[model samples]
Target: MAEKLTDSEGREDLVYIKTEDGSYRGWRVDLLIDNLSSKMEEKILLCSSCKGMLRDACFYEGDLKCGVCIPEGVAWQPVKMNREIVSDKMISCPVKKRGCEWSDTVSTVMHHLEKCEFFPVLCPLGCVCLDGERKGKVMKLERKLIPKHQRDSCPLRELVCEFCMNTVKGCEMNPHLEICEHFPLLCPNRCVIEGEEGTRQVKRRDVSVHLANECPLQKVECPYWIYGCREEMERKEMNLHEREFLHIHHRLSITDMKQKQIQMSKDNKLLEEKLDTATERIVLVEKNFESKSRELLTFKQNQIETSKQTIDKLEIATKKIAFLQNENESKIKELSKVKHMEDKLDTANIKIENLEKQISKKDSELKSIIEVLYSHISLATGQLEWKIKGVKQKIENKESSYGDPFYVGLYKCQGNIEWNYDNTGKVVVAICIVKGAYDDKLHWPIIYKYTFILLCHINSYYNYEITKQVTKEDLEKYPNSLKRPTEMRNDGLGTRSLISNTEILEAKYCKEDSITLLIKIELLPAL
Candidate 1:
């Protein structure tokens, strides 16, 4: 029968029955119950009477049967059943006996056993001990047990002195430290105090007690107990008094005296050497000065001779300079004359240039006049040729029956000219035609008769008469009247009167028949 139980901590409890002893052990319930049940089925045989479901069965607890079915006075005994052993596997508890009944699982049982406290832990150094403290004790015992031959090979066999604590060979520490002062000595005074002040005037035997309480010779850092005292003091009265009353200046004065003595000795030695050197230098300088003075005298004599020669040469140079000066004065006078001549020549050249300009201007004027005359002659010749040709053609055209007149008359009359000045300083010429007789017959007799008749007829027709307005004095003053016929026409003369007036010159009429008329005009220079 499976029993359901709980532990004190309220966890499910399991019971395992040992096959050999039939003893039970409790564990925390796990899933191994299913395996246990399956193993029990494989081990237990089924009964044939009830087909594995018998109601009353005989099972042994010890070796006795059930009390109910047995005779009276029979005792019930507990039996040890082989629990139907599944596998004889010895598994250790996983909890290492720390109040747990859990056995190690098959997969982790070896590892759990290795770390288990129930499994003895050995030293890593191979000592037969469980921990470091026991290992150390074991090593100490091993060292003690070693024989002298082994002990010589053991590093820990060497002994160290108690006082100096230096390692030495076995049994040699006492002799080695015999000279060491730190060897144990019984001192009535412990002398625990440190420093020089604690040792002064104190007896060696009582040093420790005195230093603990009353020793006054110790060296101490200053507590600055006095108002301005900052110096450290020795604990002894003598040292403190000495420090308070030491004569510092006396020592300094002694040192100063020694230094001054040394300096004076050096100065005296230097002065003596300088005196000897100065005396030698003075003697040398005096000799050098005497020699230099003699040389200077010789040089001065030479300089005097050279100066006399220079003075004579300077006199000769002075005479030559005076002569040159006289020559230079004469040359300067000649140069002044040449300069004056040059000035006069410049003035003369200016005058000559003006005269040349005037001559050039006159020549230009003459050329202009000649050119005018040539132009007039050419024009006159051309006109004369044209008039002659015309006259010859007219004569040739006349028939024999029609008698051609053998004589032809041409006349030119010049009036007397007058001059007048305008405001611009230009001269003006005026000429007037005059009435005159020509040839034996009255010149222009027909034109004169026509002029008179026409004038009378013009007076009758217009009831006004034409009269000669220009006087003879006016005609004489402007005698060259024929030269400008327009001026005569402006006198209000009839055309027949103009014709009769033009015939007044006999020479002009004769030349008209014999020679062709040539009118030549030119501009003449202004008067």
Candidate 2:
């Protein structure tokens, strides 16, 4: 057979491939150049019929089946290499186009490529991150520079946020942190407590706790203070102090409101008495004026016969009429004065109505506060049961994979469970704080932080417990900090389970193919 010389395109990026009927051909640099070995080419590829290497296509068999495999007739199936042909022949490095000068054998070329600083490979993090077609995505880099390329330089490198607990891509870290509400911030309320007492810088997330529970100088009004009670104190002592003086405040409010109402009633009665007297006096004077007018009319009729008598009587009647008018004018002035008092009484009545509304509002609030205080007292004394049930069923749904969490509970301290979040078959449990209606009972964002204890309940006191502190950052994320909240936080605070599948499978932790976990949230006392 004749030798086929160099490639027609004159490209150096080529490899050799043996075609059927015993002829050599050229291929591209996409695959390994040393896929076949001259020392034992048959080991790389052999015929199924004759156990020979694939040759020329002119003596072709159907498909890739070699004509020589059957020697003369037809071939059924294509053949494969009997075994791998380990190459040792010399070849230039594949990165020759990139100004690499070192040459080596086929087997060792891979080693050089692996170590070459200039040799390009796909970016380790596969970041196609740039403008146009590559906006914060994957790309390619050098082999030796992968460490630096994938560290902070990689656009897709996972970066832990400095301000918050979230993990984001390096390229997005700055923008994300700019808007991350949970990012640590200096307390804006710091200026309020400054110089007075117990003032200092506080992280933004912790500001709620600091103002609500920590800073002793932070003044808080008594819940009943709006109702005429004037007690003021720090937030830490608000509950206990208010608890002590609540009844006194309520009594004072009630008494003051009742007194104001009684005084208003008396004033109205007195004003009415004066107005009626003025009215009666004006009516009597009016009647007397009418009688005098009638008498004057009668005298005028009698004096019509004599001119002099008529003149005298007319003068007297005119004087008397004028006098009666003056008396009526005085009585009318008194009536006008009574009318002014009645206007004032109307204003007073309006004020009394407003006061009654306020009293009603305060009364409703006080009742709620009492109910909450009782409940809180029961909880503190360990009289109320704060445990969760039906955990196994909640976690049993296989659809609850990583990143998705399920919540159980209608209000504050809701339990959240995510099964196999880490692909380790370990369930993650979280406690969520939803805004509740017990505003008068609990401080905003739950200033009394909680310690969540999750128990497998092996027997009684000896069961295993996974404990986590409900942090200020967690609270601030979904805080109903203003007072009563109407919604829960979007995310729950929790950890991947410390106990694994082995523990959950054990009878000590699991019973009846189900597990019952005892969960409790204890308030961390004020510091």
Candidate 3:
């Protein structure tokens, strides 16, 4: 079908045919179809009666046959729908086998293939041979392979020379490197020159300058060559030569020093001649000074009498100065005393400031402690459990003990189990109120109620409880006892005979040698 389709010229060569051998020939399918459509109105129209080509189509049968072949038709009417139907037919891309998956209507298929990346394209480098049999020929490559070929294989591709970093054509890189001045070459002497601290490689151009001037392996005259030591050796060996022939070098140095001394002796002789000339001039100056001294002695005799009068006036002024010095010393001593007092005042001020700072620090600490105590009291719930371990052992040993302090409302209180107190010979359990941070803020003469429970391990019903309610009358009777603590603590208020030593040992109140005490306090509104 593709082979049958022709272009406007009626040539079948426009459409490419895919053969059994998998070879494609001639123009693509879309290109051939587009060409035929442009000329189809004139070339494809046929006369229905004559079955011949029709240049003019006045009447149309499915837009394929024209009425021009019949006698009356002189104008042409185009086959519009026929071209649209042909152009709308969907077709696959010719290069779909090369990974192009595009399939579109015949009208736009050629436009899609024009921009497709999978389609084969010539080398972008447009490389052309300048010499040899292939001269003037441009290289061709697939679009996908163009980049790799231009980068690595294209002869006309621009590449940088590794030695000089100069850009050149890829084909000319070898020739450029051959003539490059910066290209590295081995030293002719093959001397083992030390490289930079970290790298073993050194620039060859720098090494060439080093070889000409400073290379230790290069031959050099001895440093003492001008001093009559004529030895030519490598610079590295010159130091060894000097050491091996030290006596000869020392003799040469002595000779050089002797020559210097001779020159210095001549200089000293010339200096001595100049000094003799100066001494002659000084003799004449001394004679002239002797005459001047005689005249000065006469003037001094005259000045002595004038000086005697001046001295008398100076002695009187000295007496006045001595008196003023004595007086100034006394005032200075007074000023020193005042300065000492001022120093003492400054020291006192410093001490006062330090004391103020210390007081401020103490106040901050007290405030923090009060806040902690208030927080504890606020969260208290007025309930506590005191467990006394080894109660039986304490009774047997006669040991008196107190528990750790705790907060009940605003009170710092403790529970104590005393074996004997004031020779009572009875076990006493008491609750004591200690001085607390919140004491000043609390109401004096405590009005809250207190409940104490002594738990029985054997039976819950056998537990003993005590309730203490302080009324207005009782507060007046025991004013000091109920008042907020002013000292370390107020005296303990619980029963003195809570349990006898013999009875407390029983299992009813004690289990596992321990007893539990539960205390709950009720807060009252401030009056």
What TM-score would each prediction reach against the true structure? 0.20, 0.27, 0.29
Better of 1 and 3 by TM-score: 3
Clashes of each: 19, 18, 2
Cα lDDT tens digits for candidate 1, 246-331: 55534545676788899999999999999999999999999999999999999999999999999999999999999999999999
What's the ranking of the predictions by TM-score, best on top?
Answer: 3, 2, 1
Best by lDDT: 3
Candidate 2 global CA lDDT score: 0.57
Q: How well does candidate 3 match the true structure in TM-score terms?
A: 0.29
Error of 3 at 372 (Å): 99
For candidate 2, give the lDDT of residue 341: 99
Best-first order by lDDT: 3, 2, 1
Candidate 3 wrongly placed segments (more than 4 Å): 1-106, 110-141, 150-185, 193-201, 204-216, 243-248, 267-527
Cα lDDT of all candidates, in order? 0.39, 0.57, 0.68
- lDDT (Cα) of model 1: 0.39
TM-score head-to-head 1 vs 2, winner: 2
